[model samples]
Target: MTEKQPQARVMIVDDQPMVLEKLRLVLGAHSDIVLHVASRAEEAVEAARSFRPTVILQDLIMPGIDGYELLARYREAEELAHVPVVILSAHDDAVAKERCFLLGANDYLVKLPETIELVARIRYHSGACISRTERDQAFHLLMVSQRELAAANVLLAKLNGIDELTGVGNRRSFDAAMAAEWSRAQRQSKPLSLVMCDIDLFKRYNDAFGHVAGDFCIKRIAAALTEQLRRPSDKLSRYGGEEFAIILPDTDQAGALLVAEGCRMRVEGLAQGESSSGLRSPVTMSFGVASLSPTRDSDMTAMVEAADAALFEAKRSGRNAVRHAMEMRAGQRLNA
Candidate 1:
C-alpha cells in the first residue's frame, strides 16, 4: 500500500470576512493542506501559535497592528522563526513591495488581480515552503542512519575472529594475542606461561557417540576452562579441534602448573562419556605447561613448540595428567 503525504498547516490573517472565506474555499481541498483564518492581527498571532503553521498569509493594512508589526513579532519568536510569510496588499506600488521585503515578507500579492492568480500564488509559495521542510528532515534521518551502520561494521569485524560455538577466541585470535603479549612481557622482564590442553582419546569418543555429541563435549570443556582464568590478563582460546591454549601473563612455572591442574580436574569431573584410550577410564584432559622469562629476542613459535612437546610426553606417559616443559627437557638429557 502507498503511504499518504504529511499535511501542511497554513494561517490566513485578514480584516475582511469575505477575503478569509474566499481563501479557505480555494486552498481547503488541496492535498495535505489545512487552512486557518483570523480576522485581526492579534488573533493571527494566537492562531499561529496554536496551529503551528508552515506558512502565514498576512494582510498589509489591519486595525490593531499592521502587517509589518505582525511580521516583526513573528520573527522574534524562536519557535515561529522558520515559518514563511506572504503579504497581501491593496497598494501595488514599488515602495510598498520594497518595504514589505525588508520586513521579512517572503512574497507579495496584490488584491486587484484575478482570484485565480491570487489562489495560484498562495498554492505555489506554500508548497515550496513545505517541500523545503521535508528535505531538511530527510537529511537529518540519513545522517543518523549512517552513524548506526558504521557502528555495526565495527562489531561485525570483531566477531570475524571469534569462535561461534565456544564463545572463546579462535586460532587466529590466539596467535595475535600471543604476539602482542610476548613483546609486553619481554619489556617488563616478567615471566610468560602457556598451557596446551588436549581431550584424551577424543577421536574414540567421537566414534562411539556422534560428531554432534563431540561438539557438545568440546563446548562444555571450553566453558570449564574459562572459569579457571579469573585474572584480567589471563587469555584462553580454542587452538584447534579438541585442543585449547591459555596465555598466563606474569605467571611462573609453579603458577602455570596449578592453573593447568585446575582445568584437568574440572574436565575429569564432567565425564560426559567413556573413553576408549586405555590410560584414562573416563573422558578427561591432558595438559602441558611451559614457562619462560622472554627476552627481546625471544620467538613465540619456539614457546609454542616447547609446550606441544610437553603435551606429547603427557599423552605417552599416561593420559589425564600434567607435564612441565622444563621437566621434559631435563629428562631428555638424562636419557642421553
Candidate 2:
C-alpha cells in the first residue's frame, strides 16, 4: 500500500478582510493544505517564526507595513528565509510585478486566484521546501559523525601506546619518551639516568606457580616500582618479558641508584607476604643504574647499552642488589 503525504502548511498575509476570506474559501476545499491567516504583516512575521509555514501568500498593498517590505524582511530572517513567498495584488502592472520579483517573491498571483492554480503552486513550493530542510538536516548529521570519528581515532592512538597487562607504558611509549627526553637533555646539558630492573629467577617462580600467578607477580612489581619514583620526570615502562625500565630526567648516578634501591626493597617486601599457593619464596629484583650527561653528538642507544651491562653485573653478583654502570665497567676491565 502507498503511504499518504503530510499536509502542506500555508500562511496568508493581507490587510483586507475580503481578500483573507477569499483565500480561506479557495484553500478550504483541499484536505492536504493547512492554512494560517494574519491581517497585518507584523503578525505574519511572528506567525512564520512559530508556525514554520512551507509557503506564504501575501497581499502587495497593506497599511503600516506593505507586502514588498515584508517580503524583504522574510528573506532576511533565518527561520523564514527558505519558505517560498508568493505576492498577491489587485493591479497587474509591469512595474509592480518587476518590483515584487526584485524583492525576492517566489511567484505572482491576482487577488482572487483560480482554485486549481493556487492549490498546484502551494503543493509544488511546499514539496521543494521540505526537500531543502531534509538536505540541511542530513548535512548537520554528517558533520557530527565526522567529529565523533576524529575523537575515537585520538583515543585509539593513546590506547595503542599502553601495555594492556601491566597498565603501564609499553615499549612503543618508552621509545617515544626516550627520544624526547634525550633531545631535551642534550639541549639543556642535563644528566639523564636509566634503570633496568629484572625479576630474580622469574622462570623458577613461574615453574613453581602457574602463569596466572606470574602475571599477578609482575603487576604487583610494576606498581611497587612506580610508587618508588616520586618526581613527575620519572617514567616507568614494561620493557619485555619479566623486565622493566625507568627513565629519570635531570638525575645523576647517585639519585638514580637511590631510586632503584628503594624499588628493589619494595618488591622484596611484597614477596614476603603470604601467598595463596604457599609459594612464598622471597621474590627479589636486581637493578642496573646508568647516568649520562647528554651531548649533541651522543647516541641514546649507547646509554641503553651501558644500563644493560650494569644489569648483567647485578645478576652475576647474586640477586636483590643495585649496580652502577661506572663500577661495572671498571670491574670488567680489571677482569679482562
Among these predictions, the greatest TM-score belongs to: 1
Identify the leading candidate in terms of lDDT: 2
Clashing pairs in 2: none
- Report the error of model 2 at residue 84, Å: 9.1
lDDT of each: 0.81, 0.85
Off by over 4 Å in 2: 1-132, 273-281, 327-336
- Give the per-residue lDDT digits (tens) of candidate 1, residues 1-336: 886655667788999988877777777767666888888798777778888887788899999898888998888887677688888888887998888888778888786456667556666666777787788789889988898888988877668767888988899889988988888888898888999999999999888778877887788889889989989889889999999999999999999999999999877876544343222225788998888778755667777887887898899999899998853232131121
lDDT string, candidate 2, 136-173, tens digits: 99998999999999999987877877788898889998
The per-residue C-alpha lDDT of model 1 at residue 154 equals: 83
Model 1 gets an lDDT of 0.81
**Deviation (Å) of 304 in candidate 1:** 1.0
